[model samples]
Target chain A: MTAQPQIELTNIDKHYGSFHALRDINLTIENGQFVALVGPSGCGKSTLLRSLAGLESISGGTMKIAGDVMNGVPPRKRDVAMVFQSYALYPHMSVLDNLTYSLRLKRRPKSEAEAAANEVAATTGLQKLLRRLPRELSGGQRQRVAMGRAIIRHPKAFLFDEPLSNLDAALRVHMRKEIRALHDRLRATSVYVTHDQIEAMTMADHVVVMREGVIEQQGAPLELYDRPANMFVAGFIGSPAMNFVDGTVDGSGTGARLALPDEPSIQIGKRLEPGRKITVGLRPEFLQLASGDEAALHLSVTTVESTGSTTYISSLGEPEIVVVVNGRTDVAAGDKIGLAIAPENVHAFDPETGKAI
Target chain B: MNRVISSFRDGKGFDIALVGAALLFLGIFAGLPLVYNVVMSFQAVDMFSLGTFARPFVGFDNYIAVFSEPIFWPVMRNTVVFVVASIGGQFVIGFGLALFFTLKFPGSTYLRGLFLVSWVMPGLVVGAIWNWILAGDFGVLNFALTGLGIIEDNIFWRSDTAFSLWAVIIANIWLGTSFNMILLSVGLASIPRDLYEAAALDGANGWQRFWTITLPMMRATIGAVISLGLIFTLQQFDLFAAITSGGPANSSNVAQYWAWDFSFRQYDFAKGATISVLMIALVMVASVIYVRSTRHEVRG
Candidate 1:
């Protein structure tokens, strides 16, 4: 939201021997922004976070934290605090001692260190449990202690490496809001790494999606959801993933004829060369059950799964397309379903480069 | 019979049987000897009564006489110095080596494995080797020290009263350092690598991290190592026999060697038993410490 960038990464590259772990990464995170780097495992999301934390040396890059170039700076000198995925609390130390470790290491007076620990413990709800060692605490409590340890430092930026990956499902969901709320309250610049796209979509102000050593897309979550720049981004961003069906533009140039499972042609908003090959992207949530003449595609249902709140129906087509319907659906296996989608909802990409058309 | 058979199949009877075997072995080999030693310390026994259990009871005669011996205080002092110096030297050097190898350059693990050679060697063989190394003249240690200009003369490590105790201390440290390094290495390895990362990110400098993170995390391990060191150094006798023989007017003589001399050479059985009782008492405290330390692991 401001002109000044809190963290800037330009032409970042990393190599582990001959393997290029990161390539040509350029990103700017503004002050107080909650940014999430998200991708599947081995996609270098965690590696990028560690590079920002200075845990892993970058092979090549100009990484700036708070406007200072940070190439050869060690982690201790970087002034950034990291919450490890393991929570990595000192097992021998009590929660209070864990929080005060950095302060005490600086040879601060005992009273001053305890006071600082007390303040951070109060915020993290660890005040009552300060005397308990990390082993005595539950998983969630240990995680809070890990964060409290980092928070007391008042760091330049907070780097979180999959901090919620250890928690149970319900707790993970709860901590998502808590972490985002903590970021908002402190207005701290945070770079969160996760493999879960939902966490990125819901918690981050901006989300960067990465694939093997490269950023595929980055923007506001919905901006990415609505206007993904490539086939990979379109398929990766949404739940149930975007369905890609091979299609060719109609002679009229404003429509596409799907090439599978006896489905008819669908309307497109953009003009393209007639009869050009493309990959048509359709989101499951945007599809509707059609009756009279508005049907975009007719699919033979292969499987129907329901969780009382939402139902997912998949077609028994060569390129299987799934539709998510609200509430329970009577749709079952072997049912022929007629589905309709709007023109604007249809995304097309060049089949060769996977680039958006 | 049926219940026992069923219990065996279910693990309960088998567990009891396993424990009973160990207890029986301990009672025969360890418990009987320890109790016999304690009983003998309070009795008067000559060569004629040595084979019999019943001997003339002398109350505290043996303990008092043993304490009153002119060599008693000196031998006790030597034992204390031996244990303290050997343990301290082993631990410091081992810790340094462990931390050094943690940097993990190529072949460091293999090099650490090679250090175990000293530990596995018979103490007599190691002492024999050290005999050559600590020779009064034409010794490697003296050669190195004079070459470094730290000492101008050969210094006669085995003969000189000042350095005679240290001759054994030096060998014991070498014998024990590898074991210490191995255990400390395990402790260091068990500590999660992420804790250091977290500490580094918490603004701890290299020295600060070592002092706070490495030292505190190693508390249980250090306690175990030190207690084991006490037990090992107390048990150290072959090196004394093989090296100085606690010689040159009993200058390097310690309690274990004195116990041996009283029992085998002087044939004063009660005095030997009395000296051994004192050592067992010391080792009991160390055993308690070792058990407690190993049981209470400081890990999440």
Candidate 2:
């Protein structure tokens, strides 16, 4: 039989008075899996991570860690360490002491605790800074201390609550790779929470997207991007979010008619009831400029922005369509251009329910 | 002169004028009195020379007399006990209440505000209120003690020489606890909540969290509170005046109240000034600590 899941929650619920902070959250994390609970603010991603750490008590349902029911276990007893968004290093304690705090609490010998701290500090690249207090260190060093504190415990699972959100942009990218490398080296189960979809996509192996206290979807990072089960997940997963336009199935039953001026229609590549109203989603990167005979839609460019590596071109009228062209583009504003996309790249959702069709 | 006038028009003169006004006020009201008190402490002023500043330079004679008085050692001992016991009791009880209120129970804010009633009421009024509470036969304190079986009879808190100092200390603690609680609450609130969460996840129990997270993080605040508490407790004289009046042969006497008793009641202004000068030294140390801790807070 397969090993028991590292952490399991079934029908977990949380309520703050009348506000449902988390509802029907059922997640199972296996051993050594890095899971990310990602969403916009107020989406209960942090709440779910805190619940796993036992910082928040679930109002309903069972929680298990390593086959043991953790229904009422305190955070200390849960054997999970959390790195907070604020880093939360003990300001009065030196880096070594902060790393050794858990070991000391277990009444370990001073020599043993110091040895353990030294080893962890070496791994976290904090060897030279162990004697310094948190306030005496820079922000990135403090972040390393927070990570080292969690690492020393060799905890059953690691909980990271937006641990890199406080760092500068360059540092955030650097820490993202560093954390993933550290997780791989330790082979530890981790649940990270972040609002930045890019961080979640790059760092976590399994991404759980949430909205309004509900898990919208959870799958491998690419799976969520390739096939978001619904419109919210679709809109949330990609950068420069997916664009939607009102459409209806054309008379051919295999294409959708556009609502934009000039009535440009797209091939849906699947048969559907003719005249059925639907919403169509197109990703900006998938569209390309094409000749008139090969084009599915003709558009007037309203604005063109170049970020050196890629150029973004937007259409001029109702139902604005944007096209991202890799490298430089000769296209200018107010120019009429023909655009094309493969039928498989076009997505259709029911207008009423916003469900993938 | 033109430059000076231009500076005035540019508002620099107004800034200097404001600083000068504050300095002038302090020099006239606080600085001069302090210097005069120090000077009087070193002089041989008696009833005959009370109206003039040109008294004989006694060269520590007033300090010698004040220190060698029969009641001096007992009064000094009582002062130490009063300050220590009042601060200790206020700190422990106030810290407990502050922690309890941080639990954020419904109506906790209003209840904490209600505790400030004891602080806002004049200390004399508090002492008078405690006078009845500590009354020998009909006092509620006696009634509660007897009801709880901690004591079988009333102890005569105000008059009994054995418990008289303690009686005033109890009242003083009650008078000061709310201020301590308000300040400690602010300190507790300033500690980031995430630190506690981090400690908890690091496998620390609640007790460990208090020691490892709460206490260390509150170092500057605790320093500030205790120093302020020392200064305030030493300045406490109203409770003694209204309750014990340093009575029963000075059993409940302290430096501040006894200084007043010597100066105004017994007409020994030199001894009074000598005692106050000593208290000023103690308060100066406390002020140094307060300033340093606050500066550390800013740097942090």
**Estimated TM-score per prediction?**
0.98, 0.97
- Candidate 2 matches the true fold with a TM-score of 0.97
Which pairs of residues collide in model 1?
Answer: none
Question: In order, what lDDT does every prediction score?
Answer: 0.92, 0.91
As a whole number from 0 to 100, the lDDT of residue B103 in candidate 2 is 99
Alpha-carbon deviation at B110 in model 2, angstroms: 0.7
Candidate 1: C-alpha lDDT: 0.92
Q: Please tell me what DockQ candidate 1 reaches.
A: 0.81
lDDT of 1 by residue, A244-350 (tens): 99999999999999988664899988899997999999999999988778777788888999989999999855888889999997878998888899999999999
Q: Candidate 2: what lDDT?
A: 0.91
Kindly give the stretch of ten consecutive residues in candidate 2 chain B with the minimal lDDT sum: B291-300
RMSD in Å for all candidates: 1.3, 1.8
Please provide, for model 1 over B1-300, each residue's C-alpha lDDT reduced to its tens digit, 9 standing for 90 to 100.
Answer: 998799988868989999999999999999999999999999997888999998999999999999999989999999999999999999999999999999999999999999999999999999999999999787899999999999988888888899899999999999999999999999899888999998888888888888888998898899999999999999999899988999768889999999999999999899999999999999999999889987887886
Among incorrect, acceptable, medium and high, the docking class of model 1 is high
CAPRI tier of model 2: medium
DockQ of each: 0.81, 0.64
Q: After superposition, how far is residue A13 of candidate 2 from its true place, in Å?
A: 2.0
RMSD of 2: 1.8
